[model samples]
Target: MDIGFASSYLRSLFLTSLFSFVAPLLLMGSTIAGLSIISYVPWLGRLSQPGFELVWAFLRTFGNGNALEGSLVIGSTCGLVGALFDTYIFYRQNTFRR
Candidate 1:
């Protein structure tokens, strides 16, 4: 009865939070790995590493937006989690009965 859909969607939200702590790492890794070979690259460098300076222009280029990056991920995932958790609570309750 679409209960499975609710369960799966909730599962996805759970996974989001469970893995969201790595958002900053993902950004730095993407820069290193040429900005993810799968996703869209910026207009500057299409298939190469972006040379944007993050914090210390003289030394570091990444890890500048670590907290900001994590915050963005947590905010987005929290919103999703709240919505899906509310919607799926009924299914979860019913599933427990069966």
Candidate 2:
């Protein structure tokens, strides 16, 4: 693949990994924040349960809160590694240019 294509692929992988990590943090934060907001609107709060459940499951295994947290940690680590790899690739490509 050309550099552009390769870079795009890499970027997508990076974003996927970033999302894997960030999404959970975002979801967890949202969930906690939602909890506070829900208290104010009892009926709406109940309605939010399904959304929270869906996010939790997507972020974790079987909607387990702890698992979601773990995924966030692991995904962040993987994202870092992927970034470093991308940087190294760029460096090598630039170094080869006249």
Which candidate ranks first by lDDT, i.e. highest? 2
Tens digits of per-residue lDDT for model 2, 9-78: 6776677667656765675677757866774787787777777666556666633556556556656776
RMSD (Cα, Å) for all candidates, in order, is 9.1, 8.1
Off by over 4 Å in 1: 1-6, 18-20, 29-98
lDDT of 1 by residue, 25-98 (tens): 45545554453442354564543433433312322322244644544555565556655665587568778999
Measured on C-alpha atoms, candidate 2 has an lDDT of 0.66
Report lDDT (CA) for all predictions: 0.52, 0.66
Q: What is the C-alpha local distance difference test score of candidate 1?
A: 0.52
Question: What's the true lDDT of residue 88 in model 1?
Answer: 81
Clashing residue pairs in candidate 2 are none
